[model samples]
Target: MAKRAPGLGAVQETMLITLHARARCGDEAAARLVEAIDYDFAPMQRNAGATELFHVLRCAALDEWTRQFLAECPHGTVVELGAGLSTRADRLDNGTAHWCYVDLPDATELRRALLPDGERRRTITGSVLEDGWADAVAADPGPYLFLAEGVLVYLEPAGVRRALTTVATRFPGCRVALDTHGEWIVKRSRGPLTRMAADLVWACEDPKALQDWDLGLTLRESWPLSRPDWVVRRALPRHTRLTLAAVNAFVPRRMTNSRVNLYSVDATG
Candidate 1:
């Protein structure tokens, strides 16, 4: 008898890539999940070290923002859009906060098998382009923090706008944390991503441009991945710190073009 690879699309399969990266970064739970899965992760090893560092820094920044939100609103609801094998809830559970992991049916099925729903946390099977998941999240408490992470770049510009607008319209006054790639990165990513059957369609030159959508979103903070805030910077290993410093000094645009952004949803909208 043999185990089977989970039936997931190319973009969904990328979750395993991030899972492997987290495992490489010494995430015990991610490591265990990697061993449990039967897929060939060889392709994911192309740039393993860089992938691990990139994911570590990205997750660290998002985790920091999540921690800050939880600190201010202990019982607020935290919704992770397109959450695929993400161990965020496990990492940032404040005991009282509600957690909702939303994703497509295939991804959600895999996640449900590994990460079971609990009293404080649960999973919803749906697309971010739709509004059904919003209703489920609305049932939870207020002061929501929606995390899109590495999810939106897969969608077209219109789809991205629709998704963000939906969040703003439904969960006003909420906060959203997401990442965006510049056209240069997106163009370069196409070739490699095509091999995995996934593509990066949405390219944002400036995260602040999102405010022009009239979705009631205000860009609260945006920073390049290579230069995270002091909290995230302090947690990095010495090697990673030095590497990022060098990258920041020489090829600044390489990392600066892609950023992690935090936006606040206005209540009036």
Candidate 2:
């Protein structure tokens, strides 16, 4: 029998994409589940080298941020918009915090299939574009944290704007960590790195524009997402390694491919 093709539906594709990334980095759950998804993803998994390493590192950074948020707001609620198949709640679980994984109905079904709901964790079938999901999250006591990883880039500029403003308006004292592409990638829609995944139709060259949304959002940090040092030393070609070093040394901000931005919403938006 021929190998089954990987499913590439919206939202569902990201689950596979992130799973491939984690499995490539030897995440046991990701590794075990990849094959069980009914496809031979070995070729895609093999190609995951640097991209996988960077994604895994990005996830680690988010996990750390969540840890800090939990420490500060011990009973905080976390809402993961476009949750896909992420195990972040499991990875970042504090004993008291509540987690809601929000996504379209289909994706939520897949999420529920893989991970059972617990006392503190539940999956909600809904879109961030809609209103009720956030309200449900608000019903729980919170100093909230929202994650939009690999999500906003797919939304149009207006949709992204509305989503951000809505969060600020509805959940004051919330923190959001989202991934975005630079204008170059958004306009060209053709980069070696981005070409590996689904096309990212939305991009923001100036994160400062987001602040101007009049949503009372503070740009806490916007950092380039890159492969870890050990991954570079171990896996990258010699010239690629040299090029990365030069970029980091001379023009770090020119890293326009990928970024993970963290923002804080004002209590009086």
Highest TM-score scorer: 1
Top model number, lDDT: 1
Find the 10 residues in a row with the least total lDDT in model 2.
188-197
List, residue by residue over 49-128, the lDDT tens digit for candidate 1: 55456667788888999999999999999899999999988788989999999999999999988888999898998898
Candidate 2: list runs displaced more than 4 Å.
Answer: 1-8, 187-197, 227-255
Which 10 consecutive residues of model 1 have the lowest summed lDDT?
A: 187-196
- Candidate 1, after superposition: displacement of residue 39 in Å? 0.9
**lDDT of every predicted structure (CA atoms):** 0.86, 0.72
Model 1 pairs in collision: none
